[model samples]
Target: MGLYPDDIEAQASAIITTYRDRGWLIATAESCTGGLIAGALTEIAGSSAVVDRGFVTYTNQAKMDLIGVSAATLDAFGAVSKETALQMAHGALMRSGAEVAVAVTGIAGPGGGSAEKPVGLVHLALKTRSGLVDHREMRYGEIGRDQVRLATVRTALEMLAAAAQTPA
Candidate 1:
Protein backbone atom coordinates (compact mmCIF):
# COMPACT_ATOMS: atom_id res chain seq x y z
CA MET A 1 0.00 0.00 0.00
CA GLY A 2 1.04 3.58 -0.55
CA LEU A 3 1.93 5.99 2.24
CA TYR A 4 -1.28 7.95 1.72
CA PRO A 5 -4.94 7.13 1.21
CA ASP A 6 -6.44 6.31 -2.17
CA ASP A 7 -8.03 9.73 -2.59
CA ILE A 8 -4.78 11.55 -1.88
CA GLU A 9 -2.85 9.21 -4.13
CA ALA A 10 -5.31 9.83 -6.92
CA GLN A 11 -4.83 13.57 -6.60
CA ALA A 12 -1.08 13.24 -6.48
CA SER A 13 -1.09 11.05 -9.54
CA ALA A 14 -3.19 13.55 -11.43
CA ILE A 15 -0.80 16.34 -10.48
CA ILE A 16 2.22 14.37 -11.54
CA THR A 17 0.64 13.43 -14.85
CA THR A 18 -0.50 16.94 -15.60
CA TYR A 19 2.83 18.58 -14.87
CA ARG A 20 4.82 15.89 -16.59
CA ASP A 21 2.82 16.28 -19.76
CA ARG A 22 3.53 20.01 -19.77
CA GLY A 23 7.24 19.45 -19.06
CA TRP A 24 7.00 21.51 -15.89
CA LEU A 25 8.45 20.91 -12.47
CA ILE A 26 7.15 21.55 -8.96
CA ALA A 27 8.69 22.55 -5.64
CA THR A 28 7.20 22.55 -2.17
CA ALA A 29 7.86 24.50 1.02
CA GLU A 30 6.20 22.92 4.00
CA SER A 31 6.00 23.80 7.66
CA CYS A 32 3.32 22.17 9.79
CA THR A 33 2.74 19.53 7.19
CA GLY A 34 6.48 18.90 7.19
CA GLY A 35 7.46 17.13 3.96
CA LEU A 36 4.20 15.22 3.70
CA ILE A 37 3.13 17.19 0.65
CA ALA A 38 6.32 16.31 -1.15
CA GLY A 39 6.13 12.75 0.06
CA ALA A 40 2.64 12.40 -1.34
CA LEU A 41 3.66 13.80 -4.73
CA THR A 42 6.75 11.62 -4.91
CA GLU A 43 4.66 8.56 -4.08
CA ILE A 44 3.44 8.55 -7.65
CA ALA A 45 5.69 6.83 -10.15
CA GLY A 46 7.46 9.17 -12.61
CA SER A 47 7.02 12.09 -10.24
CA SER A 48 10.73 12.85 -10.49
CA ALA A 49 10.10 14.46 -13.86
CA VAL A 50 7.57 16.84 -12.35
CA VAL A 51 8.66 17.35 -8.75
CA ASP A 52 12.02 19.05 -8.43
CA ARG A 53 12.39 19.52 -4.67
CA GLY A 54 10.64 19.95 -1.34
CA PHE A 55 11.74 22.09 1.57
CA VAL A 56 10.74 20.85 5.01
CA THR A 57 11.13 24.12 6.80
CA TYR A 58 9.56 23.35 10.14
CA THR A 59 11.46 26.11 11.86
CA ASN A 60 11.57 29.86 11.23
CA GLN A 61 15.29 29.69 10.69
CA ALA A 62 14.98 26.97 8.08
CA LYS A 63 12.30 28.94 6.28
CA MET A 64 14.64 31.90 6.01
CA ASP A 65 17.86 30.05 5.46
CA LEU A 66 16.76 27.29 3.11
CA ILE A 67 14.05 28.92 1.02
CA GLY A 68 14.99 32.59 1.39
CA VAL A 69 11.93 33.64 3.36
CA SER A 70 12.84 37.02 4.71
CA ALA A 71 13.46 37.34 8.45
CA ALA A 72 11.48 40.58 8.35
CA THR A 73 8.47 38.73 7.03
CA LEU A 74 8.66 36.10 9.77
CA ASP A 75 9.07 38.66 12.52
CA ALA A 76 6.21 40.79 11.24
CA PHE A 77 3.88 37.89 10.78
CA GLY A 78 4.23 34.56 12.54
CA ALA A 79 5.10 31.38 10.69
CA VAL A 80 1.46 30.37 10.35
CA SER A 81 0.32 33.57 8.71
CA LYS A 82 -0.61 34.05 5.07
CA GLU A 83 2.36 36.34 4.55
CA THR A 84 4.73 33.58 5.48
CA ALA A 85 2.97 31.13 3.23
CA LEU A 86 3.25 33.47 0.23
CA GLN A 87 6.88 34.19 0.94
CA MET A 88 7.58 30.51 1.24
CA ALA A 89 6.01 29.93 -2.15
CA HIS A 90 7.95 32.80 -3.66
CA GLY A 91 11.15 31.63 -2.06
CA ALA A 92 10.71 28.10 -3.23
CA LEU A 93 10.05 29.30 -6.74
CA MET A 94 13.06 31.56 -6.69
CA ARG A 95 15.41 28.98 -5.20
CA SER A 96 14.38 25.92 -7.18
CA GLY A 97 14.41 25.04 -10.84
CA ALA A 98 10.69 24.31 -10.70
CA GLU A 99 8.37 26.56 -12.64
CA VAL A 100 5.63 26.13 -10.06
CA ALA A 101 5.90 26.11 -6.27
CA VAL A 102 3.52 25.42 -3.42
CA ALA A 103 3.85 26.29 0.22
CA VAL A 104 1.99 25.47 3.45
CA THR A 105 2.38 26.99 6.87
CA GLY A 106 0.12 26.17 9.74
CA ILE A 107 -0.49 24.96 13.25
CA ALA A 108 -1.28 21.30 12.79
CA GLY A 109 -1.13 20.30 16.36
CA PRO A 110 -2.29 18.54 19.43
CA GLY A 111 -0.78 21.67 20.92
CA GLY A 112 1.09 24.87 19.88
CA GLY A 113 -2.09 26.79 19.24
CA SER A 114 -3.23 30.15 20.45
CA ALA A 115 -6.38 32.25 20.45
CA GLU A 116 -5.44 33.82 17.13
CA LYS A 117 -3.88 30.88 15.37
CA PRO A 118 -5.48 27.71 16.56
CA VAL A 119 -4.83 24.12 15.68
CA GLY A 120 -5.94 22.95 12.24
CA LEU A 121 -5.33 26.38 10.77
CA VAL A 122 -3.36 26.22 7.56
CA HIS A 123 -2.33 28.80 4.99
CA LEU A 124 -1.41 27.56 1.54
CA ALA A 125 0.03 29.41 -1.43
CA LEU A 126 0.96 28.50 -4.98
CA LYS A 127 3.20 30.47 -7.32
CA THR A 128 4.02 30.08 -10.95
CA ARG A 129 7.10 31.50 -12.59
CA SER A 130 4.79 33.33 -14.97
CA GLY A 131 3.51 35.30 -11.96
CA LEU A 132 0.31 33.50 -11.10
CA VAL A 133 -0.27 33.28 -7.39
CA ASP A 134 -3.08 31.66 -5.44
CA HIS A 135 -3.63 31.47 -1.70
CA ARG A 136 -6.03 29.65 0.57
CA GLU A 137 -6.64 29.70 4.29
CA MET A 138 -8.22 26.57 5.72
CA ARG A 139 -9.49 26.08 9.22
CA TYR A 140 -9.95 22.36 9.59
CA GLY A 141 -11.02 22.83 13.21
CA GLU A 142 -9.27 20.71 15.82
CA ILE A 143 -8.64 17.74 13.60
CA GLY A 144 -5.91 15.42 14.80
CA ARG A 145 -2.37 16.22 13.76
CA ASP A 146 -2.28 13.47 11.19
CA GLN A 147 -5.62 14.47 9.77
CA VAL A 148 -4.57 18.07 9.41
CA ARG A 149 -1.36 17.15 7.66
CA LEU A 150 -3.19 14.85 5.28
CA ALA A 151 -5.71 17.56 4.54
CA THR A 152 -2.90 19.97 3.74
CA VAL A 153 -1.32 17.46 1.39
CA ARG A 154 -4.60 16.96 -0.41
CA THR A 155 -5.07 20.68 -0.81
CA ALA A 156 -1.52 21.24 -2.01
CA LEU A 157 -1.91 18.57 -4.64
CA GLU A 158 -5.11 20.12 -5.87
CA MET A 159 -3.40 23.47 -6.16
CA LEU A 160 -0.57 21.97 -8.13
CA ALA A 161 -3.00 20.31 -10.51
CA ALA A 162 -4.91 23.50 -11.05
CA ALA A 163 -1.79 25.53 -11.60
CA ALA A 164 -0.50 23.01 -14.08
CA GLN A 165 -3.70 23.17 -16.09
CA THR A 166 -3.95 26.93 -16.15
CA PRO A 167 -2.82 28.67 -19.33
CA ALA A 168 0.50 30.38 -18.89
Candidate 2:
Protein backbone atom coordinates (compact mmCIF):
# COMPACT_ATOMS: atom_id res chain seq x y z
CA MET A 1 0.00 0.00 0.00
CA GLY A 2 1.24 3.49 -0.78
CA LEU A 3 1.58 6.05 1.95
CA TYR A 4 -0.62 8.44 0.03
CA PRO A 5 -4.31 8.14 0.82
CA ASP A 6 -6.49 7.37 -2.17
CA ASP A 7 -7.79 10.93 -2.29
CA ILE A 8 -4.27 12.23 -2.98
CA GLU A 9 -3.07 9.84 -5.68
CA ALA A 10 -4.24 12.00 -8.53
CA GLN A 11 -2.61 15.06 -7.07
CA ALA A 12 0.68 13.24 -6.64
CA SER A 13 0.55 11.86 -10.15
CA ALA A 14 -0.23 15.27 -11.56
CA ILE A 15 2.70 16.81 -9.75
CA ILE A 16 5.07 14.11 -10.92
CA THR A 17 3.87 14.46 -14.48
CA THR A 18 4.22 18.20 -14.32
CA TYR A 19 7.78 17.92 -13.04
CA ARG A 20 8.68 15.48 -15.78
CA ASP A 21 7.13 17.72 -18.42
CA ARG A 22 9.17 20.65 -17.18
CA GLY A 23 12.40 18.71 -16.96
CA TRP A 24 12.52 19.36 -13.25
CA LEU A 25 13.53 16.85 -10.62
CA ILE A 26 12.04 16.80 -7.14
CA ALA A 27 13.37 15.82 -3.74
CA THR A 28 11.78 15.51 -0.31
CA ALA A 29 12.99 15.76 3.26
CA GLU A 30 10.62 14.10 5.67
CA SER A 31 10.38 13.72 9.40
CA CYS A 32 6.93 13.04 10.84
CA THR A 33 5.49 12.00 7.51
CA GLY A 34 8.28 9.42 7.40
CA GLY A 35 8.97 9.88 3.69
CA LEU A 36 5.32 9.57 2.68
CA ILE A 37 5.71 12.56 0.39
CA ALA A 38 8.41 10.73 -1.51
CA GLY A 39 6.46 7.49 -1.35
CA ALA A 40 3.45 9.14 -2.89
CA LEU A 41 5.48 10.59 -5.73
CA THR A 42 7.24 7.29 -6.35
CA GLU A 43 3.91 5.53 -6.62
CA ILE A 44 3.47 6.99 -10.08
CA ALA A 45 5.08 4.84 -12.78
CA GLY A 46 7.06 7.67 -14.31
CA SER A 47 8.22 9.08 -10.99
CA SER A 48 11.79 7.99 -11.51
CA ALA A 49 12.15 10.59 -14.21
CA VAL A 50 11.32 13.44 -11.81
CA VAL A 51 12.00 12.22 -8.29
CA ASP A 52 15.70 12.66 -7.53
CA ARG A 53 15.69 11.34 -3.94
CA GLY A 54 14.10 11.59 -0.49
CA PHE A 55 15.66 12.20 2.89
CA VAL A 56 14.00 10.59 5.91
CA THR A 57 15.29 12.44 8.90
CA TYR A 58 13.21 11.11 11.75
CA THR A 59 15.77 11.89 14.37
CA ASN A 60 17.31 15.26 15.06
CA GLN A 61 20.74 13.87 14.39
CA ALA A 62 19.64 12.54 11.03
CA LYS A 63 18.27 15.96 10.12
CA MET A 64 21.59 17.53 10.95
CA ASP A 65 23.67 14.83 9.34
CA LEU A 66 21.67 14.12 6.19
CA ILE A 67 20.29 17.58 5.45
CA GLY A 68 22.98 19.77 7.02
CA VAL A 69 20.50 21.42 9.40
CA SER A 70 22.34 23.62 11.79
CA ALA A 71 22.63 22.66 15.44
CA ALA A 72 21.81 26.22 16.42
CA THR A 73 18.50 26.19 14.56
CA LEU A 74 17.38 22.94 16.15
CA ASP A 75 18.44 24.12 19.58
CA ALA A 76 16.75 27.48 19.31
CA PHE A 77 13.46 26.44 17.72
CA GLY A 78 13.13 22.65 18.11
CA ALA A 79 12.67 20.09 15.34
CA VAL A 80 9.16 20.99 14.28
CA SER A 81 9.90 24.67 14.06
CA LYS A 82 9.79 26.62 10.81
CA GLU A 83 13.49 27.31 11.01
CA THR A 84 14.22 23.63 10.91
CA ALA A 85 11.82 23.08 8.03
CA LEU A 86 13.55 25.82 6.03
CA GLN A 87 16.89 24.22 6.67
CA MET A 88 15.59 20.82 5.70
CA ALA A 89 14.25 22.11 2.40
CA HIS A 90 17.44 23.96 1.58
CA GLY A 91 19.54 21.02 2.68
CA ALA A 92 17.68 18.64 0.42
CA LEU A 93 18.08 21.02 -2.48
CA MET A 94 21.76 21.44 -1.77
CA ARG A 95 22.47 17.71 -1.52
CA SER A 96 20.40 16.51 -4.46
CA GLY A 97 20.30 17.03 -8.19
CA ALA A 98 16.65 18.01 -7.97
CA GLU A 99 15.78 21.58 -8.80
CA VAL A 100 12.94 21.73 -6.28
CA ALA A 101 12.89 20.35 -2.74
CA VAL A 102 10.05 19.95 -0.27
CA ALA A 103 10.38 19.22 3.41
CA VAL A 104 7.99 18.27 6.26
CA THR A 105 8.50 17.98 10.00
CA GLY A 106 5.94 17.66 12.77
CA ILE A 107 4.48 15.74 15.65
CA ALA A 108 2.04 13.17 14.39
CA GLY A 109 1.18 11.23 17.47
CA PRO A 110 -1.23 10.34 20.24
CA GLY A 111 1.58 11.27 22.50
CA GLY A 112 4.29 13.96 22.25
CA GLY A 113 1.84 16.76 22.88
CA SER A 114 2.80 19.92 24.63
CA ALA A 115 0.87 23.14 25.05
CA GLU A 116 3.15 24.99 22.68
CA LYS A 117 3.73 22.28 20.07
CA PRO A 118 0.98 19.77 20.21
CA VAL A 119 0.22 16.79 18.09
CA GLY A 120 -0.41 17.48 14.42
CA LEU A 121 1.70 20.60 14.49
CA VAL A 122 3.59 20.36 11.20
CA HIS A 123 6.02 22.67 9.46
CA LEU A 124 6.51 22.47 5.73
CA ALA A 125 8.94 24.15 3.38
CA LEU A 126 9.61 24.18 -0.35
CA LYS A 127 12.75 25.57 -1.94
CA THR A 128 13.84 25.95 -5.53
CA ARG A 129 17.34 26.01 -6.97
CA SER A 130 16.74 29.57 -8.03
CA GLY A 131 16.43 30.59 -4.34
CA LEU A 132 12.68 30.70 -3.92
CA VAL A 133 11.60 29.39 -0.54
CA ASP A 134 8.13 29.05 0.95
CA HIS A 135 7.30 27.95 4.46
CA ARG A 136 3.94 26.93 5.90
CA GLU A 137 2.94 26.24 9.47
CA MET A 138 0.17 23.75 10.01
CA ARG A 139 -1.85 23.04 13.09
CA TYR A 140 -3.87 20.03 12.14
CA GLY A 141 -5.21 19.75 15.65
CA GLU A 142 -5.17 16.59 17.74
CA ILE A 143 -6.68 14.35 15.15
CA GLY A 144 -5.92 10.68 15.37
CA ARG A 145 -2.35 9.70 14.67
CA ASP A 146 -3.15 8.27 11.28
CA GLN A 147 -5.34 11.21 10.39
CA VAL A 148 -2.66 13.73 11.22
CA ARG A 149 -0.09 11.94 9.10
CA LEU A 150 -2.50 11.58 6.22
CA ALA A 151 -3.39 15.24 6.42
CA THR A 152 0.26 16.19 6.46
CA VAL A 153 0.93 14.09 3.37
CA ARG A 154 -2.06 15.69 1.71
CA THR A 155 -0.85 19.19 2.46
CA ALA A 156 2.69 18.41 1.37
CA LEU A 157 1.46 16.96 -1.91
CA GLU A 158 -0.58 20.06 -2.59
CA MET A 159 2.40 22.23 -1.80
CA LEU A 160 4.55 20.10 -4.05
CA ALA A 161 2.12 20.64 -6.86
CA ALA A 162 2.22 24.37 -6.32
CA ALA A 163 5.99 24.34 -6.13
CA ALA A 164 6.21 22.41 -9.38
CA GLN A 165 4.07 25.08 -11.00
CA THR A 166 6.63 27.70 -10.09
CA PRO A 167 9.43 28.37 -12.54
CA ALA A 168 12.79 26.94 -11.60
Candidate 2 per-residue lDDT, tens place, 1-168, comes to 454667788888898889899999999999998978888889888899999999999999999999999999999999999999999999999999999999999999899979999998999999999878899999999888888888988888888888876666
18-103: candidate 1 lDDT, tens digit per residue: 88889999999999888998999899999999989999999999999998988898899989999999999999999999999999
Q: Root-mean-square deviation of each candidate, in angstroms?
A: 0.8, 1.3
**TM of each candidate vs. truth:** 0.98, 0.96
Maximum-TM-score candidate: 1
| Global local distance difference test of model 2 | 0.91
Poorly placed runs, candidate 1 (over 4 Å): none
Clash counts per candidate, in order, are 0, 0
Best by lDDT: 1
TM-score of 2: 0.96
